[model samples]
Target: MLKLKSPQKATMQITRWVSDLDWRLLLLIIPSLSVLVFLSLSSTPIDSFPSLRSFIFNHTLLTSNSPDFVNSLPSGVHNRRESSVAKWKDELLRSRMAVCLVGGARRFELTGPSIVENILQVYPNADLFLHSPMDRNAYKFSLLKMAPRLASVRIFNPKPLNETESQVRVLTAANSPNGIQGLLQYFNLVEGCLQMIETYQKRKNFTYDWIIRTRVDGYWNAPLGPENFIPGQYLVPPGSDYGGLNDRLGIGDLNTSKVALARLSLIPKLDSAGFHQLNSETSFKAQLTTQHVPYLTKRVPFCIVTDRRYGFPPSRFGVPVAALSSPGPLSGAKCRPCTAACQGRCVAGVMRSLYKGWSWTDWDNGSLELCNARDQWERGWEKIFDKVAGKKSASVRKKFADLKKKECVDDFNEMKKRVSNWEAPPPEELCGLGLAV
Candidate 1:
């Protein structure tokens, strides 16, 4: 360097000085170089220039947007995720239903068997709530093993409770403004069903899809098909409307159920809503109409084999005519060839009395008749269950006995076939000789 060095030698000497720098100093220099490179790349906006800061910022923003990242961000973010997930789960599980079974426990041996066999058996997924005031024979009736799913409350024994007991048991008031016994009992039945819904919701963390309220004493003359489950509406029997909805068989979503269940409270609402002189059936109708709940009526394959008696030519407002001798694989609403004791022209007229805007011409006259079963039952109906139940042959008798024990009448295989074919047995076969009332 003292002598005038060449340009190449001077360049080599500068390089050597850089190479001789300490490792720690070099490490510090590397970061300084990186920063310079980053700044240069960022400032120079070329079409192909890769900017480290821009790339890093974009990746960081994307990570922040991700659920996993959001969940991990902080305590606040994690809590938010948990809350959102919980809400979603609750919404997913929310459903509407409240099954209610009412009336006296008369004919429970026959009716109970049919319910467990046909209706309840097929709807294993359903909630089965019962409200019959049990009689002395209640203990004799075969309680279905599956009943616990719907009846956590004690089976209603129709005994009069003391004032304190009544007060404790009374959950809702009757829809009747006057609070008649029938209406009060009905209210209690509905209340029990509501309690069931609440208990089920709490225990299982799920709600119902629909509540099917029917009588325990009803004998299913046929299967309870899935077609009955109408969307956003309640369903009931056709001929029993009586200017109101049939409370006997109610298929309702939760909203309808809520209005239907609020017995005493519902009356004031109905009154405020401008309704008057509502009977049980009419009140049911008012409840639906006032709450804007829609309903449908279909023939279910069953009848309320009543204890009452009426003449062949029924009074103008007489009891319904049902066939004593029916060979029914009856579609719940098919009343073909039916004769009426009421003042109506045909079964359609009977149905119209109960349900407005009902078209009953579709009823099958040949398939059904309205005969009084109470008289027959009182005479020798014990033989009827034995005969139809096929008590003769070992295999047939065994099957019948099995059905009796299980309380399930619609054999799954037979049900499947009927559903597939949509072919019901002829009324003649259902009503003739051995099948007759």
Candidate 2:
């Protein structure tokens, strides 16, 4: 039926069939071959293959033994970063710094020498500007004669502040014992100092590179280190948020200082933002955020020295007063001189139980000691302060205690002479507040 093909013809047909099969196999394997070549030549690792990288790395890390893979990196990597930071901080030392000290010199005898020894002396080139409401205790501010560069001084009589409707509406009267009027007056005191700085800068035809806003009564256990002077950000102490920034201490360049110190002027802005029942700290934070300025917070080695009384083993919403002698940076925590009733584990448990957003600080590490602040500063607290404050600071306390009225007036006159601008009620009214003629 069919003629048989010749042997040669049959062989050629078989060869043709083999060639066609090879072509079909090549088509199927070419894609996989290309992918293999691409991966082999890639600059990135196999784990970074674009599609599976994130999923792969995450799963690998979870199954791995190491929890801190980044920190487990070589020490040299961290050391270089630290070295760069140190170099940057060294450059900040050359910038001009202005120390703007505000608030009353209520316990200047206790707080003054420390300021001189810590802040003013720490930055010998920085000029001192003191703005305080005149009080009987203000005579103690005469110790500022020790400051190397005294610039401006304004110790004025406290008069009622003319409150704007905005100020009344924005500020809260609850925590403020002096009521809404007291808030206005206090705001005037802080903002008034800012005005002094502005006027001084304009008169001199030069602006400060930095402005340090601090209270008169803050006790610093350490120096105002150059680390606080960040170039583009305002610096404030950490903790004690109290629904806002810790307004107790702030450091910034001139522009930031202007905004921060515009305490009274910013009230209208707060009102516009519909903020009410705002305390000092809350309002301070609002002003900065609304203005779009950046700020940074770190643990500072200073605390607000206080004479106000608080309940011992404070309940929630109660303030825990620290002892002055407690080894602390304090960081603006309320403190007074007294025999410590709580220390070690007692302080830790109390601080731990309290709200971190409210009156809490680094109380562990023996940095805090609790006082039975249910009463006034304990009798003979001065002796306790002297023993802890060291010799140089203690000598200052004695000098103020023994100063007579005429001597006080003479000292203030000398202070006035040193200051570039002097604004106050008068030398006699100043001396008569604290000294008996």
lDDT of 1 at 120: 65
By lDDT, who's the top model here?
2
Residue 76 Cα positional deviation in candidate 2, in Å, after optimal superposition: 8.5
lDDT by residue (tens digit), candidate 2, 1-437: 21213322322333354345543354465465446434443544443332232122222221121225436535774465456546645565566778889888888877887888888887787888899988888887777878888889998878887877888789888788798887787778789888988888899998888899888999877787665665445778877777788888998888888898899988999899999888888888999999866676766777787878787798766788888888876788888777889999998888888888877777767889989988888899888888878887788878888888887788788888889998886777887888886
The TM-score values for the models, in the order shown, are: 0.55, 0.80
Q: List model 1 lDDT by residue over 236-295, tens digit each.
A: 776555555556666656656666676655665666666655567777777777786656
Worst 10 residues of 1 by lDDT: 427-436
